[model samples]
Target chain A: MSARVFINEVAPRDGFQIERDFVPTAAKIALIDDLSPLGFAKIEATSFTSPKAIPNLADAAEVMTGIQRQPGVDYVALIPNEKGVERALACGTDELNFVMSASDSHGRANLRMTANQSLERFEHMVALADGHNVFINASISTAFGCPFEGEVRPERVLEIVARAQARGIQGVTLCDTTGMANPRQVASLCAEALSRYPDMALTLHLHNTRGMGLANAFAGYEVGVMRFDAALGGLGGCPFAPGASGNVCTEDLVHMFEQMGVHTGVDLERLLGVAEQLPTLVGHDVPGQVVKAGTSQRRYPLPDAIG
Target chain B: MSARVFINEVAPRDGFQIERDFVPTAAKIALIDDLSPLGFAKIEATSFTSPKAIPNLADAAEVMTGIQRQPGVDYVALIPNEKGVERALACGTDELNFVMSASDSHGRANLRMTANQSLERFEHMVALADGHNVFINASISTAFGCPFEGEVRPERVLEIVARAQARGIQGVTLCDTTGMANPRQVASLCAEALSRYPDMALTLHLHNTRGMGLANAFAGYEVGVMRFDAALGGLGGCPFAPGASGNVCTEDLVHMFEQMGVHTGVDLERLLGVAEQLPTLVGHDVPGQVVKAGTSQRRYPLPDAIG
Candidate 1:
């Protein structure tokens, strides 16, 4: 139990971003408010992207302002540029997340620019947020394996990391944008990235697309990487990224890690309760397990064996 | 590439065993017939157990005789006792899969006998099948963790394996009865089990309850355990195991092994074709990703490029 794990809840930003049905601002606030008391270290509240881009999250500011932020919880918001950063700043977010794709193909498809241009844009956004108490984290999408490109090389991922470090970002998350990575790929890339930038905060963001989400997360843990981003209710996927299942389910990751004697600081039972509301919320059965199947300890009494 | 990889196709037996909706015997035969051409060296076709317990598979005899048997494919079936063995033998099957539980509680619950009684019955079943020209595979269910007993000690698993050896059973599959195993537990247990019984054909049958199914498979693979049991479209779970999500999705496992260059003889495209029918068949979206999301070589074009 000496292991302390960071659980970064990404449901509001990543989960709501990809969901088909529009969840009202009140529901979004209620979801975050419901999760705030669960001992989570960080909860990504919402994204400041254009309403036209992610229509479901059009009321991002309302959700951000409405939620009751528990003491010691860091409420972060996803910001794309100077404008989005300004919006998140007004919402009083404690942290700001800026995402840019690593692969040129993904960068073009996702961000409408070349890799270098995305890097330059991230630098400008970081500079704009200077002197604020807001902590900045730059995430690279498709860092593991891109659908547009069949294989992602580690050097390409390293190049993105070096660029992020140069921009004075405090942290970075290597994302398997399309979930095409195996454990070997995850081990190789994360080991290299963490070794090269030991001081930078690193996290693994993954989808259960090919069913390697938890495995890849373990690979990160084995390589001495902690701080993973997951969505409650198994809510996430990039519409642009092919083979994208939902993000690794929050309760499933919590269940696996907490059972393994890793301290995720997450309340498993509460998370499962929140996850139960998702199917009705999104109008589809989600891809998380612990949420549907209660913990092993939460079992019904069995009948006695007959002679 | 020199690694020995074996696949135990449980689509016929485990796949259809838990379904409420009946697949016609003709369709079941056609499914197995279609799978035989895909280079599966071994396939578990049906269970010869009493139909009183599992009515969906009452027509086991018809399934064994109806399918177009491919040359070199070891067609196996489940047998509980002498009567089941006689039926499997009469059908001219190639392999006999006799399952005994590792945990006493699960043993009695599933087989209506104590652990020792199950082993004693297995000895008789093996003796009766001697000179019957059927390959014997002894599977130990609840080998990882049992729903009844909180944690099934690996020592108990080794005990079951030793019993199978004494009874002259040629192979053994260690199953996670309630999908309650993590990768470290999976690897450590497989290593411990493999060390004691190196010559016994070792296979792992996993459930995806906690989302660690493929990770557990990889852990077992890392420990030099090759053979694995999987179902198409994640379509199976023990009815007795409350809240067990389903068996490991066959295509997901195939995707991992094939990506890492471990041969399993499954074509992803062909497997996805089978998976595409799952939603229509089950009347809901099955918990599989590769079928809905194309392979890496395949990708959907996305707009709004940064690169």
Candidate 2:
């Protein structure tokens, strides 16, 4: 591995949902369409989650149908159950992401099931996806640390990964659900999983909860984690987790990696332009710093700047 | 070593200089007075830089003399040149920090000189401090990435470190003057420097400009770096760098270290209390998130939080 990485853009789905106002499905499609040309390998287009659960993304179907797809981009969606999967599959989802929390409290509050039951349900979801030739990504939410459990054991994460692997899932995403992860924890879990399961592909879905997302992403990169999840302008949060933050900003992460000579196949300037479009679309100040300050390497000579 | 780290608070000097309003010398003294009991080994009390250059801290002498110093806390001052040193020593300073840029362009923009010239002057400054009983810390600004030069070589950093060693300064602080450091860059430089000069202590001064400050701090930690520069409430940036950001937030860094069983010897809540006072004192939201969100571990249950 020559340190190649994959970037998954989730701004359209998770980022849009966090906004206080309802961003129209056409706007969501347009945003994803603009990002389509960027070299993101996967764009999680929308979620087939219940409207009541996340009212902001109520028109997930319209977003999925309306986007103009780029040739090489993998547009995916988050599906909660058989019904959501049916809807996503009906709408021609190329990739399906099924999420279940590792914590029992979260599993219940989120999915109305225990971890074991969620795993059993995931088996059915995987079976459903196998029939459609759709790749299923098992995202174990709150895998690093949960708001309820406080400290989630690695054994639990490994257990979930093992089960996720057993179902022949395409990959597993370790999410810092409430953004309770530091670099040490991110390094340990991702390294342990990748080491133990050589065949299992691991991805990181990070939140900037304590401002450790990019660092955690870098730590994973150090351990040969090339695939990651990010949102444009750092949009998205666990709406349930009050005081929690948005995901690692796509532009910021790409800017950091591209500057470091890590090839992410993403266009930095284009991403920045895409990010600048969001504030007006969403009617609020988005929480990204890179778009605001410009890249650190970006500078004009003082004389020229004055000129 | 068991990761017992030392956080040198540079908010008063580094944080205040970039800030436009002149924080009263009385407030500067009171900040140090209030912070004296927080178990910090060193507090950068004030800068004796050209008051004409940075008029905000013109009363550097008043602040240096007025702080209620605890017995062991070493009050350090930033010395731009020999003149700054003479002024600081007269005000009863125990430690002196001399800064120079690693890149010629930034050096010119910053200190109105070249890199070679700055390094040469550091030797003379160190000699001046030798018999004066003042501890000299040679801070190489823009060591990670230069605002003018895109990437800074680690060999150049080592060369500057070697100069600091030749002058027998206390140690060298590698400042990410524009907050453009990554974990790998931080790790490699620290490892190489520590290997070459085992006796000289290494400190990493980071900026959250790219949101990798804490990660860079940890990268330094993994490679046996124990001394770090953090501003209370994340309140500092280099004015010379166009898009520079604040240093690593003190409370955030302390929180990470304390949680990892890495003893910083600094109280987390007590540090947060200090951070909380900054908004009222600074009249703006200082960048420390822990003040607004509480510690990473401070999770609120909905039942308790709703009321």
lDDT of 2 by residue, B1-307 (tens): 4459998999998898878688988888888888879988899988899888889888999899898888888899988898998889898898998888888888877788788898788777777766787778888988987876778888988988887787777788999987788777788888999899888878889998867787788888988888998899889876645444588989888877776778888877777877888988988877775666556686546333232
Q: List model 1 lDDT by residue over A1-307, tens digit each.
A: 1287898999888988877788888888888999999978899988898988778888988988899989999999888778999899888889999988888887777667667897889888988888889999987888877777767778988988888888888999888877777886787788888889989988889888778888878767777778889998778887765446789889988888887778889888878888899888778877888776666554434446533
Model 1 chain A lowest lDDT segment of ten? A298-307
What DockQ number belongs to candidate 2? 0.46
Distance (Å) between predicted and true CA of B146, model 2? 2.3
Give the number of the best model, judged by TM-score: 2
Provide DockQ values for all models, in the order shown.
0.50, 0.46
Structural similarity to truth (TM-score) of each candidate: 0.94, 0.95
Which regions of candidate 1 deviate over 4 angstroms? A241-244, A303-307, B1-4, B242-244, B278-285, B304-307
- lDDT (0 to 1) per candidate: 0.82, 0.83
